[model samples]
Target: MSIADPVAVREHLLAAAAAGHPLTYSELLARLGHPFTRPRMRALCKTLAAVDDAAQADGEPELAVLVVRQSDGLPGQGWWTGSWEKHRFTGDWTGPDARLLIDRLQRQAFRYWQERAPG
Candidate 1:
């Protein structure tokens, strides 16, 4: 039996997640042109789960998806909130401006977390 490719595994998983449905490792592998092998699938799922946990802890937004619509005679965009998340901001901004705002927010969050992290 051939070993599964981790790069392929990640890409498949990310694509599946982006498509709005989270798939288990077996489902991911099956979609990735392989009959799922239990050990490899387990290892891949563990690694992906750990990476996802770290990103969430660091406040890196998963999905980073923006839904846009017209509201009150202006265009607006916002993220979908669920569980522990809250939707924030509804202003219309240019693409570059949005990038700048997101970048600044990320930097601030990084610094704030660094200050709180144990050395």
Candidate 2:
């Protein structure tokens, strides 16, 4: 699949979710036959979020995608979790301030998702 192919990506994600097999970022990219890259991943994330919104209009399950940095000492070492239900994120943080910011963002995102109508 082309890296620009959001339709294919969304289809794969929905299939995986329906099969009870959620995908990590790497796994999702791999399934889409694309190599991992920051830009591609970001685009995919955006696309998946849009897909979730569309699905919401049809009363389909939402696809929740979460990306977090790892504390393994490797810069930019992170992974993504994608599922049909929202997942709470809690782990090492850059600092207390960063944690607070993340919390606020997460809460805002949750509310947005909760109140969004299919568009």
Candidate 3:
């Protein structure tokens, strides 16, 4: 929750994702109990992306959650599974848009896992 606590933020995100519920950036900020600002959002995104990258590099591909900035003329950002296209989570960087994106992402992740699950 503290501005200096990347570990807390990382853990919070992982837990949220694992809860089998959709999550939004606003919800994430509320969980952190931190003031929301453009700079803070940027920092949080950067930190999460770094953590995901490190996990991938460590051969924990399944645990990786990628954060990407959209550059195709879309005003949004997104997260992805190890196979990015298989489970992409995207949303505008503002307001209620993130909630919709999170919902879609959760659904995609659910479908992905279900398809891969052993019968």
Best candidate according to lDDT: 2
Residue pairs with clashing backbones, model 3: none
TM-score of each: 0.35, 0.51, 0.50
RMSD of 2: 9.3
Off by over 4 Å in 2: 66-119
Report residue 20 deviation for candidate 3 (angstroms).
Answer: 1.3
- Residue range 9-117, candidate 1, lDDT tens digits: 5455445434443354455556666665657655544444444455467665432221112232111222212212442444335465554554454344445444544
Best by TM-score: 2
CA RMSD per model (angstroms): 12.7, 9.3, 7.9
What lDDT score is found at residue 73 in candidate 2? 15
Q: How well does candidate 2 score on lDDT at residue 97?
A: 48
What would the TM-score be for candidate 1 when compared with the true structure? Answer: 0.35
| Candidate ordering by TM-score (highest first) | 2, 3, 1
Candidate 2 backbone collisions, by pair? none
